[model samples]
Structure formats: C-alpha cells, structure tokens
Target: MLATPVVFIFGRRFFISAFRQLRHGKAGMDTLVALSTGVAYFYSVAVMLLPTFWAKKGLPGHLYFESAAVVIAFILLGKLLEMRAKGRTAADIKKLMGAQPATATVLVNDQPQIIAVRDIQVGDQLLVKPGEAIAVDGAILSGRPLINESMVTGEAIPSQKESGDSVYAGTINENTAFTMRADKVGRNTVMASIIRLVREAQGSKAPIEQLVDKIAARFVAGVLCIALLTFFIWWAFGGPAELSRGIIAVVTVLVIACPCALGLATPAALMVGIGRGATMGILIKDAAHLQKLAGVTDIVLDKTGTLTLGKPVVQEGLWLDDDRDINAGYPKSAARLLAAIERSSQHPLAEAITSYAISVYGKDYSKNNDIDFDHNANAASYINSVFLPGLGVEATLGNDVYYVGNARLMAEKNIVVNAGSEKDVSPEKPVDFLTPMRHDLTAITSFLQAHTTHTIVYFAQKSAKDNRGTLLSVMALADILKPDALLTLQRLGHQGIGLHMLTGDNEAAAALVASQTGINRYLAGQLPADKLAYIKTLQTQGKSVAMIGDGINDSAALAQADISIAMSKGSHVAMDVAGMTIVGDQLSKIADGILLSRLTGKTIRENLFWAFFYNLIGIPIAAGILYPFTGFMLNPMIAGAAMALSSICVLAASLRLRYRKLK
Candidate 1:
C-alpha cells in the first residue's frame, strides 16, 4: 500500500497527459505506459483490499503493487537522463550569447561615460579600449587597432582596423584604443542575427522529422491493436490457466513497445549537429538546409572576394611617349591629366592608380619643387566627368579630353593604337606621342597575357584635329589570392564535387585565378541576373547547387541556389539570402560543413534504424511469441526496463555526434 503512492507520485504527470490524450481521442507513447501500469496497480489494489474476490478464481491473489511502482520509477529515471543529455546539445548557443558585453563606454561632451548597451543609439561615439569587446557595429574614427574577429568570423588571425573601417559587435580589440560612431545598435548587430538563426534552426524540423512524427502517431494505436489480438488469440486456444496468462501477455506488449525512442530519433541528432556547427563557425539557418548541404553536387563561387582578397593593387604602368621613361616618371602634364581622370572614378583599378600616383608622387606639384604634380587636388577643375558603366571614366582637363578604362573602353571611343606617323623618340625632337601609345598598349597587352592574372586599365586622349581618341597608357593591377584557395578546391574536387567560377571580370583574369586555384570550369563577365540564370540551369539538370558569394551581385544567385553559403566578409544582402554563413570566410570550412552534414545524416539513419528495430523485435517477444519455443513468457517488470533502455540508447547514439571530428 505504501509503494502504491510512490507510483502515483512519480507517475502522476504521465497519467494526466495520457488522460488528456485519451480525451482528445489520440494515443501516444505515454498512453501505453499509463494504461499498462494503471491496470497492474488497480488489480493489485483489488487483491490487497478484497482477498476473497481474487481467492474465488484461484488466481494465487498475488499483489503486483511493487511491479507497477518500480516500472514508473525506472521510466522517470530514463526521462531525467534524456533531458540532461538534450540540455548539453545547445551549450554552444549559450556560449555565443555570452560573448556580448552588457555595457558600453559612450563619449558625451568629450568625456567618457559608462552606459548600458541597449541605451546606445545610432551616431553615439563609443570608446573601445584594447582587449575590450566592441559594444556595437560602428566605424573607427581615431586610433588603429588589431581586432580579433574569430568570435564572429571563426578566423583566429587579428585583422588590422584603422580609421574609416567598420567593426562589429562581440569582436575584441587587440592593442589600441579607438573611438567609433555607432552605425548599428541593439538587435541590428551581426551577433544578434546569428543567435536568432541558431535558435530557429534548432527548433525547426527536417523532412525526415515529419515522417518520424507521422509514424510515431500511428505506432501507439497499432501497438494497442496487437496487444488486444495477442490476448484474444491466447485465451481462445490455451489451457485452463489461459485467462491469467493472456492478461500478462497483454500488459507485457503494451509496456515494451515504446514510441519515445521513435520520436527522439531525428530531433536529438539535429540538435547536436547544429550546435557542433556553431562552434566551428558554420551557422546553419534551418534543419532543411543541413539536409540540402549533403546533396550538393555542384558549387558556384564568386571570383573577387570569394577567391581573392578583393583589394586590388597597381603592379605596373606603361607611358606612351618614348622620350619619357615610366621609371623616370610619367610626363608631368599627362600625369596630372591621367590622375585627375582616375580620381573621379570609383572602380577598383581606378582606386589602385590613384593610390599608386599619390604614393610615387608628392601631394602637391609646387610643394616638393621637383615639378612633379599631385593631381588629386586638381581634379575639381575638370568638369562634367561621366562614368560609363563597365567601360571606364571620361573627363576633360583644360583643352584636352582623357579616358581611363579597359581596352574595350578605348575601342568603344574609336581610339586607334599605332596610328601616329612618328615613332622614334628624342627629348629635343617633337615625336608624335600617339604613335608610341600603340607600342605601350601592345607591351601592356603582352605583359598581361604572360602574367595571365593582371587587370589592365587603359588611358586614352582625343586628338586636336581628329576628335577621335588615341591610346596614352595602360595600368595593370591584380588582387591577391587567398592562401587556402588551392587546397580547398583540391579537396572539394577530390570529393567529386563539380566546381565553377562566376565572375564579372574578363576571361584572362578569371581564368588565372581559376587555374591557380585548381578550378577547371568557369564563367566570365557574368552579371547578377546572368548568375541567377546559370544557377537555375544547373538545377534543371538535376544537380543540387551551392552558390558561394559575398557581394550585392551575388544576392540574387544566392537566393536562387538550393544551398546558399555566404562568406563572413560578404555584403549584408548576401548573408540575408543565404541558408548558411561561413563565419571565418574560410573556403575550407565549406567542405567541413558539407562533411559534417553527411555525418549528421548518417547518425540520424543509425538512430532511426535502432529505434524501429527495437520496437519491432521487442513488441513480438512481449506478445509471448517466444513462449511456445522457450516455454517461458516475458515479465512485465523486465518489459518496462527494456522500454526505458531503448530510449536511453537512442539518446546516447545521438550524443556521439557532439564529439565527431570534422574537416
């Protein structure tokens, strides 16, 4: 009688939930446990309260109070262990949330004031001292510092941040104090976005999870039917003691067939897998994306930032006049004109030229007294400058008109190379500079072909008489390829993944990076819409495509891909459209994410197989299927223990994923 209260106390929740499910005309795993234990406990109560009632049947009047109470105790213990294990799966998200600081140092009236992070508003000047976490996303205003972005991007190396550079929240400053005007505060920060994504991913279910849920719902009703059939069949065919034997078999079947393991099979593995991905800096946005990642057969990569540093630097420049050697310096008059035109353009090549000119020549022509000019300040005098998309910039300085762009721009303006009559050069002689312009263009072209990776920017001028343009100079620039690019491509290639490069650059530059990085297929001069079309084409071919990019141009394609992966350094729109974000901008992590997904898929399969196998085998044995062969029946207490063990085993198998090694 004392033990009966123990069962009611520990098993109260289960019985209440089972009653609710029964009222709604639905059955769950709790229903089986509640019914089996309730029947045993009430039957034992009847014997204890009225011994003469059971004595009439000659049923031995055995009290089963201990059996029912012990079964509920064991099941409750298993549930507690499972809950603890599930709690460990989300520890990574907790660690990520802990990285953000609660307070910030805001500059007010030129004095430092400590305030809560949530109180910070846009345009507030914040101070970030060395080793302190950045309070919000902002642009640096004063001191230069090395920031450790590993918390956000997963790359451990410290990145140098100076004036005008953007910094994110939750990142730490390394060696200098800096003040920044806050640009994004509160939930607008990247850290907040990552947290939201991780939580949603953990809660969302995959397609397989839906299938498992459907089976679990039906599984309970099916188990009850089998138990009823087993009892009836045995009562109709067995000997005089069949009444008691049939009742034991019915209770055993209900006790041993557990749907808890079936329901836990998919969710447990997904939780561990997503949490593990977070620790590695791979933010999976949804459980369905994890499934899609494993099926990716083709990958499209953006050229500029994805494969290279995206910062181009001038390598060399060629002067058109033979009398003026480029090493000596470009002719003062033309250098000023070229510099003024390039400074007006925002293209990467133009920026490289402007930077190179400022570095090689002084800021002012008269300040140094060497007659070399700094045309950056003189750019205001040139009026009506027009930017031609994809071509170059056109501008006028005094009586001369200048053009700075690729060779295609020169061709579009009808500027002819090698058209001048005079070629021989002398400082004293008036040699036609236009004729030597063709020589420089040819030399730059040959150099670019030999290098295969340099971007050439051409300079041209219109003749006083002809009005059509003549080539003046060519500047070659190149961006640095990432150190891990080649190895990442090689590994992906070895895994039988088809790699293709999509870029807005010309063929030569694109080919060079592709070849150097071991990517065999490529598409050059692709616009944003074109890239999106290409992704759709690949999908039509029955290939699941993963598009990796980090710019505004890649946003459309990223949204169109089955699996979209964005680099950490990429634009906001790209990250917003992508299904997964590679936090460190490490190309190698792409392969790691894919490999982890495959492993997670395997784990889910193993869990489901074990869950289904346990139920199928246990249900039959509990129904007394082995009684005739072994002359023995399964005990209700042993059946309850077996049911609890099955759920514990599934949880243990899924927990193994937290320790699996990733690439």
Candidate 2:
C-alpha cells in the first residue's frame, strides 16, 4: 500500500499522456507503458486487498507491487540517460552561442560606453579591445587588427583586417583595438544565422524518418493486439497454473516491445552529425540536404571565389611600342591611360589594372606640371563614358575614343588587332616608331595568348579619321588558386566523384584552373543561364550534381543544382541559396561535409536495424513462441530490462558519430 502512492506519483505522467493520446483516437508508446504498469499495479492491489476472494477461486494471489515499481524505475532511468545524451548532441550549437559576447562597447557621443549586445542598433560605432569578441557584423572604419576567426571559420590562423574589410560577430580581436560601424546586429549577424541553421537542421526530419514515423505510429497498438493474443493462447492451452502463466506472458509482451528506439533512430544520428558539422565550419541547412550530400556523384565548381582566391591581380602588361620594358616612358604613359579609363569601373579586372598602375607608376605619373593627371581630374576628361557588361568600358578621351575591355569588346568596336602587320593603321600617322616595334608587339601578344593562361584585356584607340581602332596594349590578370583546392579536388576525384568547372571567364583562364586542379571537364565563357542549363543537363543524365560557387552569377546554378555549397567569404545571395555553407572559404570542407553525411547515414541505418531487429526477435519470445520447442519462457523483469537496453543501445550508436573523424 505504501508503494502504491509512490508509483502513482512518479508514474502518473505516462498514464495521463496515454489517456490524452487515446482521446485523440491514437495510441503511442506511452499507451503501452501505461497499460502494462497500470495492469501490474491494479492487479497486485486487488490481490493484496482481497486475499480471501482470490483463495476461493484457487488463484495464487501473488502481489506484483515490486515488479510494477521496478519496471517504471528502469524506464525512468533509461529516459534520463537518453535526455543527457541528446543534450550532448547539440553541444556545438551551445558553444557557438557562448562565443557571442553579452555586452558591447559602443561609441556614444564619441565616448566608449558598454551596453548590452541586444540594445546595439545598426550604424552604431563599436569599439573592440584586444582579446574581445566582436559584438556584431560590420566594416572596420579606423584600426587594423588581426582577428581570430577560428570560432566562425575553423581556421587556426588569424585573419588580418583593414579599413573597408568586413568583420563578423564571434571573431576575437587578437591585436590592437578597432572601432567599427555595426551593419548586422542581434539575429541578423552571421553567427546567429549559423546557429539558426544548425538548430533547424537538427530539428528537421530526413525522408527515411517519415517511413519510421508511420511504423512507430501503429507500433503500440500492434503490440497490444499481440499481447492480447498471447494471453488468450497461453490461458486456453496451459495444463497447470493457466491464469498465472497468461498474466506473465501478457506483461512480458507489452514490456519487451519498445517504440522509443524506433522513433529515436534517425533523429539522434542527424542531431549529432549536424552538430559535428557546425563545429567544423560546415553549416548544413536541413536534414534532407545532409542526407542528399552523401549521394552526390558529381560536383560542379565555379572558378573565381570558389577554386581561386577571387582576388584578381595584374600579372603582366605589354605596351605596343615598348620593347618588353615596363619601366619605359611609353609603357608608363599607356598604363596611366589604362588606369584613367578603368578607375571609373567596378569590375575586378578593372580594379586590378587601376591598382597596378598606381603602384608601378607613382600616384602622380605625369612629369609635366602643365598637365593635370590626377585620378579625379583624368576621370572628368573622358566624356560619353559607358560600361558594357560582360565586355569592358568605352569612353571618348578628347578627339580619340578609347576602349578598355576584353578582346570581344575590341571586336565590337571594329578594332583590328594587327599582329606583326599594320593593315588597319592610318597612312598619314607616323609609322617610324611602330615599324621596328611591330614584330616585338606581335611576339609579346602571341606569347601572352599561347603560353600564359591569364585573363587578357585589350586597350585600343579608335582613330577619328578611319573610324577604326588600333590595339595599344594587352594586360594579363590572374586569380590565385586556394592552398587546398588541388588537394581537395584530388580527394574528391579519388572517391569517384566527377568534377566539372563552370566560369564566366575566358577559355584560357578556365583551362589554366582546370589543369591546375586536375578537372577533366570544364566550360568557359558561361553566363549565369548557361551554368543553370549545364546543371539541368547533368541532372537529366541521372547525375546528382553539387554546385559550389561564391558569386551572384552562381546564385542561379546554386539554386538549380542537386546540392548547393557556398563559401563563407562569398556573396550573401549565393549563401542564401546554398544548402550548405563552408566557413573560412576552405575548399577542403566540401570533402569533410560529404564524409560526415555518409558516416551519419551509416549510423542511422545501423540504429534503425537494431531497433527493428530487437523488437522482431524479442516480442516473439515474450509471446511464448519458443515454449513448445525449447521449453523457454521470457520473464517480465528481463523483458523490462531489455526494453530499456534497446533505447540505450540506439543512443550509444548515434553518439558514436560525434567521435568519428570526418576525414
């Protein structure tokens, strides 16, 4: 009688939840637990209270108060262990949240004022001291600092930041203090986005989980039906102690069949896998994408900002009348003209040329004091300046028109590139300076075009008399490859994954990157639509393609691919469309993400197999199927222990994913 109050107080949750589920016309695992324990408790109570009534019917009148209490105790212990293990699965997310500082030093009226991180608003100037974590995402306004981004990017090296460079929240300032204007605050920060993505991914269910749900929904009801059948079969056929044997068989069947293991199989694995990924700087958006990553057969990569560093620099430049001498006066003059035209454009190549010109030639290259050749002054001299997308820029400089762009842009302007020949040159102009340098210019252009794989830009001058342009100089620009790009591609290639490159750059530039990275198939000069169409074509051939890109042009292809991966350093548009975001802009994380998915998938399968196999083999023995053959019957206490062990086994299998190395 003392144990009855303890059982009701501690075990009332199961009975109440089971009742709520039955009212909604559904039966779950709680229903089975409630019915089994309730039967044992009430039956034991009846026997203890009416000993004379039971003796009259010839029943043993055994009190099962200890059995009821023991079963509930084992189940509660199992639930407590499972909850603790589940909490560990989200440890990475908690670490990320902890990385965020609680307070920020904001600049109020040009004075440092410490305020709550939540109270920070956009455009607030915040001061970060050395060793302090960044409060929010923003651009540096004054100081240069070495920021440790390992918390966000998983890179051990601290990144050097300068004015106009972007800084994300959760990164620590390793060196001197810096003041920055906040652009993204609170939930809009990158750290918040990563945390949100990880939480959503862990909570979301995979496709295989849907099937498991359907099975678990009816599992309790089926177990109840089997338990009823076991009781009837055992009671009708037993030659001695029929009632006692029937009650034991029914309790064993109900206790041994566990639905909790089946329900936890997939989610447990997914939670640990995604949390592991987050720690490694691979943010998976959902469980479906995480599962899909394991089956990717092909990976498409973008050249700029993906395989390469995306920072284009001027590699070499050749002036028409200068004999391979960049320091010559004419070469400097030509570079100045190129900078004057390119400084107004925002293209990466254009910026490279402008910076090269300023660095090679002093900020003020012109020697004559009479001519004002400053950037702002030179920019104002050109009239009718227009930027042509996918080509270059055209501007009217005095009486002559100058074109600074790719070869295609030169072709559109009717500029004839005379290699070693002066066919399009005006007859009236001086040919004395061009005669000796014509062969040198041709050799230089040919060498640059044939030997070097750098992106070439043509600078030409359109004559007012002939209405045709003459090529003046050729500039070669190159985007450096990432340190791990080659090794990452090699690893993926060894795994039998087909590698393909798609870029809007020229064929020469594309060929260089492809050769360096060992990519056999590549398509150059591809626009955003072309990239999208290519992904579709590959999908039609029954290939699962993962598109990895880091630009606005790649947004369409990223959205269209089977799986989209974006670099953290890339544009927000690309990351927004990507299924996975690789922090630190590391190419090797792609392989890590895929490997983690495969391991997680394997773990989920193993867990599901164990859950199903345990119930399939345990329920039968509990139902007394082996009684006629082996003369063995499963005990109710042993069945309860087995049920608790099944859930623990499933959780242990899933937790193994946390320790397994992704590589």
Candidate 3:
C-alpha cells in the first residue's frame, strides 16, 4: 500500500492518465489505480491508528503522527512514476494491432466503397489509386507501374511491376494504377506480422525479469520475518518503554525495503538494450537470442550465393578455331564472339560481357537490339543469348550472331559440342566445354564436369558467315569481391562469429565466391530444403546458429536458426522469417548487434546486484544495528530514502545506454 499524503499530492496525474486510459478501454490502468488507492487507504487508516496507540500507551501524539506521514509519502510517490512508465511500455499488444490500416476502399460489384479495415475479407477486390498507400496485401489484376516499397522493405528505389505482380500493404505505388485482389486484410498482412513479432519480442522478458521477481518475493518474505523477530525481541521481551521503539523499528524496516528497485532491475536493462539495437539496424528478436549471440563461435557460409556476387559474368574468351565450329566446342575465339553479342544486349550477362569488353578493350560494345526477343519467331535473336532465370545471361558464339544466355541459349542456337574435345589455354579443359549445360545438372560438380573449356578467351566477330567467324579474344569474364567484404569477414571472425556463404549456383562458383569472401569452410549444392536440414542438424547437435539471408529461398533456414537475420534489401518472405533485419546490406551490423546485447546484459546484472544487495544487507542495518550500546536507531525516513536510492541506481545505469555510441 502507498502512503496517504503522497496519494493526495499526485492523485491528479494518476486519475487523469488512468481515466483517459480507462476511457480508451485500458482496464489494467484503471485496476492498478484502484488497487493502489485501495491499498493506500488501507495503509493510511492503519498508520492513523498509530498515534492513538501511542497516546493510549502514554506516549506523545506529535512524534507518532508526524513521522508516519513523511516516511510513507516519499516511497509511494516513487512507485507512482515507475508504474506510469511500465503501463506505457507494456501496451505491446496494442502497438501490434496499430500497424494495420484502419480502413480500405473495397470494390463492391466493380464500384469502389469505403469500409472499416477489419470488415474486409480475403478475396475481396480493392481498387488502389495512384499516389496512395496499399491498404492490404494483394495482387494487381491490371495496370503496370513502378512501386516504392521503402517503408516496408527498406528498398528506397522504385521498381517496376506489371499485372500479376504482388504488392504488399504499406508499399506506396509510385506511378501506376493497380486493381488489387486482396489476399490478406487488416492485421494479417506482412506489416501486421512485423508488428506482431516486434510486440512478442518486447513482451518476452528475459531470464533476468523472472529473477528480479524471485529476489523481490524472497526478500519481501525474509524482511517481514525479521521485522516480526525484531518486534518480539524488543517489545514482548523488554520493558514497557521498549514497545514504542519496537513499533518504530518494525515499521521502518518494512517501509525501507519495498522491493521496487528489485522489480525494475531487468526491465531497465532490457529497455536500454532493445533501444540500442533498434538504432543499429539489428533487432535481437528475443531475450534468448540477445544473450546467446554474444557467445557464438562458428559461422557457416552458403558458398555461391552468400559471398561472391551471386551474379555470373564473362571472364575470358578466345578464338580456338573457325572450322572448329564456334558452337561445336569451347574456344578462346568463341568466348570473344560471345562477349561482343552480349555487348549488343542490355540483359545482365550482356551487361557483364559488355562491361568486360569495356574493361579489357576500353569500349562499351553493347548492341542496340532492334527487337525484343518474344518467341521462336525471334529464333534469330535466340541464336545470340541464353537466359538463366535465377542466375544471369550466358552468351553462345554460334554460326549465326553471338548468342548470350544460359545453357538453353546454346542448345536453341543448335550449337552442340562434345565435352571430350580439348582446347588450348588457361583453365579447365575441352573446347567442347562450351556446350549447353544439361537441365538435369543438380550439383555443382555435375555442371563443372560438363564444361570442357580451359582458357576462356574474349574476342569480337563480324558475323556468323565471316571467314574469321564469331570470336572475340580478350581476358576471361569474372566476378570480383567487393573490397570491404573480406575485411568484414575477417573482423567478424575476430569477434568469434563464423561467416558462411549461401547461393543457388554451382560449387566451383561457390568455392570461388567463398574464397573471395574469406570464408574458410563452406557447403554448396544445397536447395532450400537442404540448407534447412543442415540447420536442424547443427541445432540438434547443440549449436547456437544464426542464419543470415536475403531471399525467399532462405526462409526455411531463417525460420529454423537460433537467430535469423535478414538483409534489409531482401525479399518479403525472408524478412518475415528473420528475427532481425539489417536496414542496409552491411553484415558488420551483426557484430555490432551482439555488442549492444552484451552491454545490456551487463547493465541488467549490475542493476540486479544493487537491487538485491541493497535489501539483502540494508534491512538489518536499518533495524537499529547498534541500538543497545550506541542506541543508533534508524528512522523510517532514512529507510525510505535508501529504497529510493536503489531505484535511482537502476535508472542511472539504464540511462547510460542512450549514450553508448555503437559505431
């Protein structure tokens, strides 16, 4: 129970915030106020009886009434502020529900109508106007336009989308009109999921939270026992004059050690850590991941997709032979011819080779395609490039124009080569290595075994009929590591965090990427399920693993990991699965996240120590440690002041997090 005078002093703020909260349907706040007032009044009437008891026992009225009022007032006021702060933050569930849009324009019989967001159901059609927010997750049945998904996905740039493109709520349609088929409404959308996860994470108190309760419960019980003992020793066993002093001692100990500070220890630290992590582009997701991440020792990398640029580029090409059938096998001359045709195209592989041409030959050789490749009617265009859907473009130097694309492009051009044939030059083997890759190639080894080219040479050819044939010889096409990637990997290693790679490409490519990224150990040839299985295997063996990914394919692994981190530039599915998302592509943020979590952990321990030790040791001293000889009895006010001091210590420690300056 709180003291009476303190209730009268600040009764206004409590009743106001409480009443306002109650009007908004926050019963907890109302109930808490009622409980506080009820408990306060009960204690008030008890303390009022104190002066009567003293008078009846032949003591002065002035000493008994005045001291009781002052001591109780101070402790109660401190508790009031703490309760207010807790109520504000503990509205986690409300915050989660707040992320949804309150209303949406629904399509009724093809006419737009407004309705409460909650009333909209799945399968409802919603008309999305230009320059407005998408109110729900839906697919566009019509119109093609670009979108800005920055608020939801952190992708600031506008990306174009056509009919059949899925748009998420909270994503702004930059310059297009889309009629949406609502797949998810209100709190069930992706944005709603993020809000829900954040809420759950926040409400989830750490072990420290329960520990504080344990300490407070135990300390409160023990203090009451000792106060009872103190009353018995002085009043029942001593002279009549001792009863007044015993009454003062018993109340003093109870008032001085309320356990307010102990209850706050874990929460104070948790708030600091959570706040710090949010600013650093890392969300710890839960107390368990926050604490466990600080101690991770091994990082496994998914090779092809994680480290080196997942995109493939033309490395080297050479003219091996003209009669050699440029399409028949891999040749230095064919590599260069493929490089030139790619220069004519604007596709990724085309740009890769075009860039290669500029780098090696100092000329941007892109061909202005007069027509977009549509179907077999553009079979002439098919002769020049092969499209690897998830990967990049590959070029085939053929009897026709230079072909660029996946293995399919080479086959479409009718350019088949026997892998057994050998060629001259730098790397693998077989001029026939230039053949179309088999669709059945599931593993990286299977793909490499099919390629027989040694030195990839780059060259430009005039046309298929040219006596010199389509062959441009120069340096090989390749991908290089970003200069900072290696340093990030190495530094993360120093912090005892493992770096792993993930990719959907071949193993040789995977190894090359891993080598560049400085990851010493790697696993390749994994489909999404394979990666998930690996995560489960490691977890079963008792490993604390964190999976970092930025694609839909990584969703399963992200879900199964002890900690899931998504790239801010990643797909929506990946972001949904991860515990935290980096606002930028930098992986160094992971290391920084762990540092902040550990700092919060330290603060929690410190606050608990002070809260625990204050009650553990202070109550005995406050009960008149030297009462017999020196007669140094502790007053109720001093005990109340000590209780306040413990709370202040916790608050001061937590405040330091605001200035922690994590780089």
lDDT (tens digit, per residue) of candidate 2 on 531-592 = 77898899999999899987655666776777889999976656765768899999999999
Stretches of model 1 off by over 4 angstroms after superposition: 1-206, 213-222, 234-251, 310-434, 437-445, 448-474, 478-480, 503-536, 551-560, 626-637
Model 1: weakest 10-residue lDDT segment is 364-373
lDDT, residue 247, candidate 3: 70
In the range 1-663, model 3's lDDT, one tens digit per residue, is: 433455555454555655775687643322333333433344446556676776677644332232333334433544543343232223433433444467778889988899887788899988777677788888888876566654343222244566788888766765546688989876677666655444443344534336544654455456657878988888776767788777767766665565556656666666667667777777544555565566565555443223434344655443334345646554433333444456555443455655654454443334434322222223324455543332234444334444343343333433333222323321233223233333212322343344333112223333444322222233344444544567768778888776666554446755766655667666665655566677777778777788877655565566667676777665655665566676666667777877776787777788878877887677777677677779688766566567667777888888798788664
**TM-score (C-alpha, index-matched) for candidate 2:** 0.57
lDDT of 1 at 319: 63
- TM-score of each prediction: 0.57, 0.57, 0.57
lDDT of each: 0.72, 0.74, 0.56
Q: List the candidate 3 regions with Cα displacement exceeding 4 Å.
A: 1-41, 45-220, 227-235, 238-251, 278-281, 285-287, 300-402, 406-408, 411-469, 473-483, 495-506, 516-521, 527-533, 657-663
Better of 1 and 3 by lDDT: 1
Report the candidate with higher lDDT, 1 versus 2: 2
Best lDDT goes to which candidate? 2
Q: Model 3 Cα displacement at 63 (Å)?
A: 12
Worst 10 residues of 3 by lDDT: 418-427
Report each candidate's C-alpha RMSD, comma-separated, in the order given. 12.7, 13.3, 11.2
Write one digit per residue (lDDT tens) for candidate 1, span 1-663: 577677788788879988999999998767876887787788677777998855775656666666677657756654553343332225535655667899999999989999999999999999998789998998999886777764454332345676999888988887668899999998888677655544543444445536644775788789889989998988888854677778878877776774556656666676677778889998876555676688889999998778887677777766664335656766555655565556666443566787766554545442223333244354445445676545677886556567887676777676655445334433344323223444555675576666546666777776555545667666777876877888888888898899999987778778888778878889887756677789889989999999998865576677678788888887655675566888878888888999988988888789889988998899889898988899778877777678677777887898898898875
